[model samples]
Target: MDTKISVVENGALKRVGKVFAEAFGQTPALLVADGNTLKAGGFETLRSLKEAGIVVRQYIFPSNPQPYADEYAIQIVHETLKQDNSIAVVLGSGTLNDITKRASSELDRPYMVVATAPSVDGYTSYGAAVSIGGFKQTLPCAAPLVVLADTKVLCKAPTDMTASGFGDCMAKFTAGMDWILADLLGVHPIRKDVWDMVQTPLRKVYKKRSSIARREASAIGILFDALSASGFAMQIMHDSRPASGAEHLISHVWEMEHLSKDGLPVSHGFKVAVGTMTIRYLYDQLKMVDINSISLIGGESWADRERAVRSFFKDPKVAEQTVVIAKKKFLEGEALSKRRETLLSIFPTLIKRIDEQLPPYAELKEAMRMNGAPVSPEDIASNLEGLRHAVTGAQMIRDRYTVLDLFYELGIFDQALESLQLM
Candidate 1:
């Protein structure tokens, strides 16, 4: 639960090299970054390490720069860790940091992150999502030994990236709700400290919606603080449940489908943003949990679920692999079913419970827009199909106790699809 990295003033990134020097003695640093980030922040990081009397070695991901976490990337980072006995220093956020965190953990080397954006909460999480044998999965890993986010530079990050971060942060609202539901059903034990650590900053960000839009120094700083808190929560729980939810699953499904326009991959937070809208809409329509409708649910058979799995992956082997990951990694079957009923049985009345602990959706949307985030699904991409795909896939990727899963279990998925069309 100790958050190692510090988000300091603008010029502090240049001092990271020296800080590492003092912590681990004068040693070389293996700097890992992407092509764009290398230009934006990598050069300065390299210079700072050299000036601080530490040896420097750099390794950027290969080719025309596609940011992903696959076997090839994991192997490359592993090689870099072995090439020299230097501590790994990742200079970008999310994808780059995830790949490095997994690779260095495998190499058993200490690692640190210098975040370039107010991005996803994964900055300090202990697990990494990677495609080991073609299926996207979150493999267990360790948290970074340190995290450094320079707020000045982060405030100026691309609007879309900032928006994605907000989407990821907003996810905590529904995600926490799902966790509480699971707790009520005794599906899993809840950790109150971990939950509050992730949820507290959410209220603060919404309260300063106007200031956040101005990108005032204090606003961006506070936003980043909230983002970091989620990471620390993951470190404490050693699970993403405190942060990720049905929204993240949708993003993964998009990734597997290779769903891009003209070959450009979408941002993770963008997909999650749209997914958040889809799930929230579903939540709004429920008349009741309808515990008796569980038996009326369609596609409860293994063959039926497998068919949905086929739609997600082309290779039959990959399809089987996908099912295996879902079954093993995600908590499914009886437990999720019972919890869905308990949560839904509470229904519209539970809205009061959710409101008591979370910010109003409208206020949160304003905070995100002011912070340069997507306010709706349409704000993320060009078409509604992408949003549809994100919603359906979000349901498939995780076994978390979220409202989306509740909708699917209660036979309202089709109706939800119809509602999405209206949107």
Candidate 2:
């Protein structure tokens, strides 16, 4: 909601000066970018700002290792920005933008992003996915004051990056399904306007898979729009429930484990793409489940659940924190039994919703394939065993009510895990 301006144009980079001047009015700006983004839009961005008579400073991250949105990275940027009164202007995708967002928030200042790729929807969202002490978490922050994207730059991004963006956008299918499920269970109801904002454009982009794969400007612009809309949806909800669900949880598990290739962590979209496939597959399997056979296995005792959380996290401090967070949502005994009854009572409707909300698993895979996005675990350098582990870890880490929670509650999680075949 804090984001006041949103620009998507063929030559948006050239409007950096006018837009920045209009918003902040001659305030010195701190331009943040990695070496790659700096090369891509730095010159033009700087020229535009100077032409508008805006004083600007540049903070370029080295490209070799690629900057991460981790505590160390946040600290470095925060330290640098604290020295000046410059408004932050991030000029990259996920990580750089997250770094700037968190740092600016710490300084009680707002920032803007000049998105180089449609990579992820964190740009206008008021949270930063950052790792501290090796644990991944979405730290609260201010949404960008402006989100500017140039289709010309976006279309030229690496095919995998754009495809990754498509994958992230596509995950909205399952995200929406999860929200609907939560709504049904009285966990969190959907906001109709936010739902329409995210879901409508999502369907449009999903239909343009080939165009996105071909790097067409129009298609890429739509992808950016949908991604930004997703951020706005999250903003409206004041939480990620509207935009992230089980798929993102899987990505979070992978992040905690540092899943990587060629010494670099996998992109968020690539991980979520595979997560989307996994969740869709689970939903497909859900169709075959016999609700009558889903006997109530009493929920784990809090002490036992706490132990599992501690063991799963492998960090005493983090495990302690997780237990405190989990305590609120961890059900037991009569509560668990009643929950099972409620789930049983709603089983038919739940199935109908799943059927209505999800595309066929094969169809979803085809869409991902059409966009050159990774459609399987192996494509993202992960295997079923590893993903199963991630899925388990994901369920334990977050108390959010997702399909994963439903499956876990019903004692069908292991069965569903075993059902996954090589894709």
Candidate 3:
């Protein structure tokens, strides 16, 4: 709702300056981009701003290692922006936008984005995903004031980028299911409007996999729209509950571990795509779970959980902080007993909801294949060992009640890990 203008037109870049002038009244702008994104639309973006009589400054990152949205990169942008009062105009996808978003928020200035690819849904989201102190976290930030994209540019983006966008979009299936699970478990309830805002557009995008793979303009536009819609949903909820879930947590673990291929960190969506498949597989396995045979862990003592957190994080400070967060949601004693009882009572309903909310695992895999998104850990250079570690670490790192937590609570985490190995 805070995003005032969103354009996905054919030559949106050509009119960006005019649009900005009309919306914000010719404010001085700080155009941010990287070497790659600069080559994509830098000249035109500058020319457009100039034509509209807007003074603009440029901050372009070199392509060699690329600009990571890490603490160092954020500080660089923050320091530069602090020297002036120019409004930030980020001209890239994902990381660049996240960096600018956080930097602008630190300065208490509104920023705009001109998307070069439909590679992520962070464009209009209210948090910047950054790696700081060796921990990957989402730093709260303001949503972009305006989001503009040229369908022509998005359609011509590298195939992997578009596929990554699709993968991120597809993650909504699991994210939605996780929210529903959390709601039923009394963790977090779903808001009808927010759920509809993200899920409705997602269904349409999912049906256009082939069109997206072929780079059809209409399909690409739809993908972009869905991605933006996801961002808006997150903004409205003031959290990523509606847009991220177990899959995203898995991605964060891989990110912190520096999982990479060809000496470059894996793309966020690609990691998430594999994670989506893994989570989907876990759900499939859950279908065959005989609740009668499974036994719940009575409850973990705070000391035991703290020790687990410490071991998982390997950093005393981070583990301490994690325990504090975990304490907020960790159940024990009567609460745990009640949770178990409630879970058993709703088992049938939960199964029904899972069946209704998730697409078949094979169907999801085929969709990824159709769109060229990774469908397995191997595709992203991750192994079962690393993935198993990620699954465990994911639950420890977040207090969110996802399927990982469900299995852990049910004392079947080892079984789930084994299933992942076999898969």
Candidate 4:
């Protein structure tokens, strides 16, 4: 894993000048931020850096939410890099962090983040999910050298954004469970060390949910630690399988469709939160039915059960994806026997370990309420149609082996879809 130095003290930012001076040895830093964050704390951060005798250059974009982390925004940072050899520092959350992460990777320079909100997990992750040519994808990037979050700033963030973060964090429960399933099926290898590292801070933070909402030092510190550890997990594994799963894909669909409510786009975490519920509902329904008996009720009406995806997708594409996955499993039956058995042997242990780390959805929601996070799918999407569309969208991209793929291969997708209507 890349060396991650996280400094997130309440008044620690005031000492940023001294910190930067000590770490960089006179090397200058390019401060990247958008208007909202500039107004929020960019000036103070800059002043502190200069006060510590560190030379600095600053870039600020207008406050419009749309002017963030697109190819155009990244271009400006890329072009600015031509003028100097300075490490980059993002003074905002979400887009600012993503753009800087991508830009710094392109420049082959280390970057750090001064997080102004707890809006998303891309903060410390090694890969950045961005929209390129109107398609949503996760592109390779380097993790930040340091991650600093001021709880004061995080607590002051817009309530919806905080809710989005809560939603994203909660999705980890279902996502982690799916990871266990994939391990059982022998589709992928699970990294026990990485899993434990990211999970430790998660346990501490979840237990202190009210403190996070109140911006208590210890609680915010734990959240920040877990977030950073998550980034490191991706850095070490070189994949997001340990972190994001189908829930993130659902969010991507919303991004591609440009869905919004009340004239504003919903945050990524918010979309995933609802997707989490939808997936759990699917599992809950499954516990009451027999997987083998599924097709008898609904014919394998999905598309061909031998392919990975459908280039032309609509709301019911999940059904098609399911049939395709099911056929693949049928073919792999003989070869995957040992692997499946190994996964089964370890799955119970994985679930037990995960429970020790992250909170369940119900408990997670209570934590969110305490931390000022949002509570429902309606809270993230503009309307019900948008939510369903995003969930369907998630099915199309990333042939990543996930629980969604598992049910699809098992020909039980229709069951998952029908369950969504109840939510």
Candidate 5:
């Protein structure tokens, strides 16, 4: 929880200098942005810092190709920071902030952010979602010390960016349900305070979806606040379990493969939106299953599981990493029996939590559609087949207990996946 200052308001960008001065008095600052984000708020941020008597250095990444959060980008920023003692003030949303988060963390320094969009929740989270060796993962990083977002700027952000943020916010519904499943099964119990921190604002944003589409300042402010609350929840828990679940894991799998459309990489929120819908559909299907009827007597052998992981992930390095993680939670023999028994014992409670936690599948889909989020796999430059693979791959990539694991453990993962009618 390194963040000391968090403000989302109209014209908050005007307070950048004052806020920076308060957070890091008289410290020289490095302003980071790309061409598009530079126009968004970089100049104002620079001007404010200079007016506050702070020396400022600039790192303007080219905007044509759009910056990505990758090891190479982190290296460039890492080298830049190595040459000076200036604290970083990242001026964009997801990509730029992620790069700076990892780069600054490498030097054991805290950074600040002036959000250009309500794009993603990694803004004040403890881990940076980045690609290393072409594999997407969350790398350790310190959350920003100060987070400032001006609704004036946010309301003008590209509609898709706002929609992306909305998608990410909506994901909390499914992510929270996943947590409930874990908590009920005695894997990772929910923390009441952190649960309220994220879930409360999520509902507020859901109510204001239409206003958010209209880019109403109040609605955008609510979206931004909800996104920040998710980050704060992760900070408090020191694990993404508070803010991420299987939906994010599905996004990670797609990110690893560089899922893109129309010559541009797909936004994280778009990918997660699809995952959210997909997971919710699975939850609906889960309700129809009778725990007594499920035959969990035999399951995939470890050797077969290893083969599937190796075959699904083409890159040997990725396959290697996934195999290691998959091995940790691949239950069989007595372990499988015990897990099945526990699931059976908790079946009624699991269904109860799912009922209370998730919206109806059709209603959830309508919400995503009305908010301009992708409602089908095709909307994300992925097909049903690709999504199916992504779901299985997602299960293998993380040891996190999710509904994916539940079906897999029940020995009906393929049946469950095939039952999904996401055309």
Candidate 6:
């Protein structure tokens, strides 16, 4: 909602200087980018801004180790901006955008982004998902004042980055279903407007899988638009519930643990892609479950859950912090009974809604495969056992009411894991 101007088209980058000049009247700007994105759109953006008579400075990060949105990165950007009055113009996808978003917010100045890739939905979202200390969390920040995404630039992005965007876009399917579960159970109700804003455009992007795989410009533009729509939905709702669910939590677990493959950190979209498939499979299994035949049982005690949380999070600070979160959602005795009863009573409706909400697992898998997104945990440098651990660990780290919490509260957490047979 904070984004005043958004242009997604071929050659939109050409308008960067004019747009920024119109908005800020030739305000001096800081162009933040890493080595890769700097090559992608940095020079063009710089030229465009200067042509419009805007003075500019550059903060080019070395791309070798690849920058991540952590506190250290934020401090550098914040200090850089603190030394001058220049507003920022970020030139990358997720990490650079997040770093600049947080730093700009800390400085109480607006910023813009020239997207080199359609790699994430955070471009128009109100919060920066960054690692503070060792824990990954969403830090409150303002959205960009303007977003300029060039399809030409986007179509040239590494195939994996586009695949990552596809994965993140595809995640909306399971994310929506998770919201349906929470809505139906009367825990968190759905907002139809925000739902339509995100889900409506999601289907259009999913239909362009083959085109996206070929790096077709129009389809890639559509994907960029859809990703931005999700961000706008988040901005409007001030919550990620409309765009993220258990799948994101799964990714969050890997993020906190710094999951990596082949010596490089895994991309967020790739991790979420795997999490999307896992959640869909879990939904598939849930469909076959006979709620009536299952007996309600007691859940873990708060002390036991606290111990598990502390044991799972190796970082003492993260563990100490997560123990409090774990306690907030731990259910037992009558509280657990009421939740299970509500689930049983609504089991038929839940299944029906899930059927209507989620696409067939095979169809979903093939779509992701077409986009070159990860279809399995191994594809993201994670194994089934690691995934299972992440799924359960996900519930403890966030108080978000998701299907993961549902299974735990229903006293069938281990049973669900056993059914998955992640081995």
Report every candidate's CA lDDT: 0.72, 0.87, 0.87, 0.67, 0.89, 0.89
Give the alpha carbon lDDT tens digit for every residue of 236-322 in model 6: 988889999999999989888889999888998999999899899888778777787666765678878888888898889889889
The candidate with the higher TM-score, 1 or 3, is 3
**Residue-by-residue lDDT tens digits, candidate 4, 46-158:** 88899877788988878865465678778888778658988787888888788888888888888778988777777878877677876566788878877777766666677
Give the TM-score of each candidate: 0.84, 0.94, 0.94, 0.83, 0.95, 0.95
The alpha-carbon deviation from the true structure for residue 416 of candidate 4, after best TM-score superposition, in angstroms, is: 2.4
Q: Write the per-residue lDDT of candidate 2 for residues 246-289, one digit (tens) a residue.
A: 99899888877789987778989999999998888888788889
Error of 1 at 147 (Å): 0.8
What's the count of clashing pairs in each model shown?
4, 0, 0, 8, 0, 0
Worst 10 residues of 1 by lDDT: 289-298
What's the CA error at residue 365 for candidate 3, in Å? 0.6
Residue ranges of candidate 5 with Cα displaced over 4 Å: none
Q: Least accurate stretch of 10 residues (summed lDDT) in model 2?
A: 292-301
How well does candidate 1 score on lDDT at residue 383?
61
4 versus 5: better TM-score goes to: 5
The per-residue C-alpha lDDT of model 2 at residue 99 equals 92
After superposition, the stretches of candidate 1 with alpha carbons farther than 4 Å from their true spots are: 1-5, 60-68, 132-135, 287-314, 321-345, 375-389
Model 5: per-residue Cα lDDT over 58-124, one tens digit each: 8889998889889899998888887889899999999999999999999998889999999889898
In Å, residue 187's CA in model 1 sits off its true spot by 1.4
Rank list by TM-score: 5, 6, 2, 3, 1, 4
Candidate scoring better on TM-score of 2 and 4: 2
Q: Per-residue CA lDDT of candidate 3, range 264-359, in tens?
A: 788988999988888888988888788897554476787888778788887677778878877786778877767777777777788888878888
Q: What lDDT would candidate 2 get against the real structure? A: 0.87
Residue 48 lDDT, candidate 1, scale 0-100: 77
